[model samples]
Target: MVSSYPVQFDVDFPARPLDRLTTAFRIIVAIPIVFLLAALTNDTVQGDHHSTFTFASGAGLLFVPLLLMILFRQKYPRWWFDWNINLLRFSNRVTAY
Candidate 1:
């Protein structure tokens, strides 16, 4: 019989020896990416990235509109659900990296 699982995760280890110096400074080096992820996920208030960040409500990650649609309208838009799924996948990918 064939397996029927729907999702899977796999990670490959590095082939060469890791550098201790870089490893020690990994947190410092990862600042940019951490900030990027923060900007993508966090919904900031007044004066914070008022010009640069344009994502409203953190790129639909919270899905409050979708929740309202489901609660009041009794219907869920497929596109909104897909958007949430893709965002989650992207988040997972970044964390995995």
Candidate 2:
């Protein structure tokens, strides 16, 4: 029997041949995007002497809140779901690249 899932994902293959140079150097090309994703998500930088903490304002998903809500109230807010899904999509895209 067919089933309807709450969420689904798909990616289409490229019609044209993949660029050999880009394919070979994908890691180099993806460096910036990976860093961007890291900054968006939870990323920390440390120094030897003075420890400075940096966080992008309102950057990460509502993980703790969502977990608490699910555990205590058995609820998942729509807004939080949207935020998490979008962030996940960005992370996946960066990783796939």
Candidate 3:
């Protein structure tokens, strides 16, 4: 006898073009701001160059992804779509427009 339980399933949805580009832009801009704030706070607490440099390095590392994302935003719309769709899982029933 089969149990009368709700089954779980995964949905395959395509990401929208604008959503992908916007997300990449937001991430590219936000990472540095976040890391900078954290580093500055740590530096204030510890009064040392170590945390400052650590944060700076992190910001530098983030720049590459930011630049790459900006450059490829148009070229890799589909890839961006996949990334964005995974990032923003809206309800399928929701209608916008």
TM-scores of the models, in the given order?
0.48, 0.49, 0.23
Best by lDDT: 2
In every candidate, how many clashes are there? 0, 0, 0
User: Taking the tens digit of each residue's C-alpha lDDT, what string does model 2 give over 1-84?
Assistant: 455987776789989988888787988878898877776787677877789676653554556767888899888788877877
Best by TM-score: 2
Worst 10 residues of 3 by lDDT: 88-97
Q: Candidate 1's residue-wise lDDT over 51-88, tens digit each?
A: 55435546656567668888998988888779779878
Ranking by TM-score: 2, 1, 3
TM accuracy, model 3: 0.23
Mark the regions of model 2 whose C-alpha exceeds 4 Å error after superposition.
1-11, 43-77
Query: Which run of 10 residues does model 2 get worst, by summed lDDT?
Result: 54-63
Query: Which should have the higher TM-score, number 2 or number 3?
Result: 2
Better of 1 and 2 by TM-score: 2
The digit string of per-residue lDDT tens for model 3 on 1-97 reads 5657788656766675456777678767766656544443323234566653333443345556766877987465465557447433432222121
| Model 1 vs. true fold: TM | 0.48
Candidate 2, number of clashes: 0
Error of 1 at 43 (Å): 7.8
lDDT of 1 at 13: 85
